[model samples]
Target: MTSHKRWGLFFFLAPVVLWLFVMIVLPHIDLLVMSFRFENDEGQMQWSLNNYLAFFEEPIYWLTFVRTAIYSILVTFLTFVIALPLAFYITKVVNPKYQGFLLVLLLLPFWVSELVRVYGWMILLRESGVINHFLLKAGILRQPIEMLYRDSTMILGLVYTSMLFMVVPIVSVLDSLDNSLIEAAYDLGANMWTILFKIIIPHASPGIMSGSIVVFMLTLGNYLTPNLMGGKNSLWFTEQIYNQFIASFNWNQGSAFGFLLLVLSSIVVWLGLKLTRQNLKKVVQ
Candidate 1:
């Protein structure tokens, strides 16, 4: 490469490298240090494992963490199940002329902010809200149902908010597939299920893995949907972190919880890759 081309490449990469180091690496290092320290009875700051120990010692903390992990997994799985068929339909069944329009429809909800979307659900699901009001007027129910502030509602919110992330990846992969492959499989006497499992799935595995990872992480870390939809009944781990930092002013404990969440997400992603036998390099591409 010429000197000018090398300089151009360096300038192109420098901003990203600097941004990652400044925004991600530095803050995480500070948080890691904070997690290990605590104020003692004398009001002296001391380095110790008390913050982490408190998480295991408190039932509420550890139980909520486990619950968050379970809920996040459910959300990811639900998003995958919902997105896959929609993606396939858009990529394969829809007329090419109308595919862009249909995809835009899927994206329309996302044009609004997440806060607005969650509040919209609140309007639909709350007692005396749109659904209940319609049902009551239509003589379908005796009274308004209490639909808000529930686990199912929270999961629905997460899935709705994360749908586009899942669909885009799957559609991108499926769009790249050649129609000849499906025809060849069918010509060899393969049924739909056989072809789906043997051919389509293998080709789309990377996209599936990529979408699952993104959805899982976003759902796990999300605070707004659970807080708004589930109300106080939501025992999400992010709520715990929020309380430690904002409500209780216990930064040490909050830092510990934050790191534990990071660790948990890393472990889950690693296990997913292992089970799927997917290469991270290929999946990201």
Candidate 2:
């Protein structure tokens, strides 16, 4: 390219490039620098591994990390299972008018903030909530059953929030598929189960993989749902990090934990790409 063309390209990209460097790269650099520093006897900052040492020595951090990982995995799996069928039903089976309607419904929750959704769940799961009231009226139970603020409620909230990510991608992919291929499979004595497992799913594997990665990452970073739905017993990894940074004002240790989560998420995303052997360029394009 000519000098003028190069200058023009640079001008077009300058704002976004600068914003990324300032917002992302600078903060990460500051975090890395802070992670190595600790308070001295005089209350001045000094370089050491004390923050990391404390992290490794403490069981709470590791336990919360494991719990977060498990919760994210479960949420991802649940989102996939529910989203796949819904996407398939919408794209392959449902009428076009109704498909659009259902899509609106699927996206309706997004109109409300996630915090609002968590509170909505809180109402339903509480002792005097609609669910328990109905159950009692129907004689299903003698009294209200406790369902909120537990691991199960956290899983439910995670799955509900993350499911839209899974649905949109799978529907996009499935909508592009040739319906005749499925019809042909059925015509050739293939059952619904066989056709789905052997053909339809394989064809949409790229989207499924993409959706899984997105949902896992989102759920892994989630704090509000576990805190609101899980109550005092939640003790999620993100909550721990929040407490360190915001509540206790331990910036160095919080940065270390934040960096740790970043590393772990990167590794998982790498493995996901490896397992699928996906050309991310195709997905992006």
lDDT of 2 at 121: 86
Local distance difference test, candidate 2? 0.89
Candidate 1 local lDDT, 1-285, one digit each (tens): 699999999999999999999999999999999999999999999999999999999999999999999999999999999998899999999899999999999999988999999999999999979999999999999988999999999999999999999999999999998989999999999999999999888898899999999999999999999999989999999999999999999999999999999999999999999999987899999
What TM-score, computed on C-alpha atoms, does each candidate reach?
0.97, 0.94
Q: Clashes per prediction?
A: 0, 1
Q: Lowest lDDT 10-mer window, candidate 1?
A: 196-205
Candidate 1 segments whose C-alpha is farther than 4 A from its true place: none
Q: TM-score: which candidate is best?
A: 1
Model 1 TM: 0.97
> Highest lDDT: which candidate?
1
